[model samples]
Target: MTEPERRLWQIVRAGRLGFKFQRQVVLAPYIADFAARSERLVIEIDGETHGSDSAYDARRTADLEARGYRVLRFTNADVMTNPEGVARTILMALGRDPESPLSPTLSP
Candidate 1:
């Protein structure tokens, strides 16, 4: 995993955000960076190189969505610089309350 991937993994793993997420899951031809199968959500951590591949990403996202999954993409910079905000966004996407007492803030 990339550094940002590792960091975000620590925040989201083990049902931390009220859902189970698996890393590097294969959905037929594509491998998702993180997947909470129960919620049908696929999270992708894109690096700087990804800017050149938006078209491919769009197709991949479409394919994933067609396969019944909602895809969320975050840049390495966003994850590294604002993980807490990213986590909150993910929690919102999962339909969970980010302000709930059970929710965890980003660690120092």
Candidate 2:
């Protein structure tokens, strides 16, 4: 993992979102940045290096999805600048009830 990836890994591992999410789950040599097994959420933090391998990423995502995982991708900038929003987006994508305190409202 690069510097930015390591930073996001720390955030997720801290469990600041009050959810039980794990960081750096290694499925062979490829390690997902963050993962919530119960929700089947796999979070990937993309940096400049990702630009060079779009096809590879697509294939990897497809394989993970085929195994019933919901893969969420975010740029390093997004994670560094607005991590709360990223967390909320993940929660919303997992069908967390908007009315619940844990769910952030969708803006118009």
Candidate 3:
């Protein structure tokens, strides 16, 4: 894994968001950066190289969406600089209600 991916993993692994996530998972023809299969959500971390590959990324995201998956993308900088924000966003995507209270501690 790249540095950003490895860093993000530390925050999201082990059902930290109240859902399990798999790293480097294969979803048929495409591989996802991280996926919560049961929730049908895929999180992708894009590096600098991806800036030149928007078309390919779009096609990949479309295919995954076609398969009933919702894709969330983050740039490497976003993950490395603000993993907590990313985690919070993922929780929201997983239907975590911000208005409701959660455990003070993040661990599940």
TM-score of each: 0.95, 0.76, 0.91
Instruction: Please provide, for model 2 over 4-106, each residue's C-alpha lDDT reduced to its tens digit, 9 standing for 90 to 100.
Output: 6666665555444445678778755468888888778899888879999999999999989988889999998887777667666776676765347764332
Candidate order by decreasing TM-score: 1, 3, 2
Q: In model 3, how large is the Cα lDDT of residue 97?
A: 63
Maximum-TM-score candidate = 1
Q: Model 3, which residues run further than 4 Å from truth?
A: 98-100, 103-108
1-108: candidate 1 lDDT, tens digit per residue: 789999989888888887899999999899999999999999999999999999999999999999899999999999999998899899999998888987765463
lDDT by residue (tens digit), candidate 3, 64-104: 99999999999999988877778778878988863457722
Q: Evaluate residue 99 in candidate 1 and report its C-alpha lDDT on the 0 to 100 scale.
A: 86
Higher-TM-score candidate of 1 and 3: 1
Note the Cα lDDT for every prediction shown.
Answer: 0.91, 0.73, 0.86
Error of 1 at 12 (Å): 0.8
lDDT of 1: 0.91
Q: How well does model 3 score by local distance difference test?
A: 0.86
How good is model 1 by TM-score? 0.95
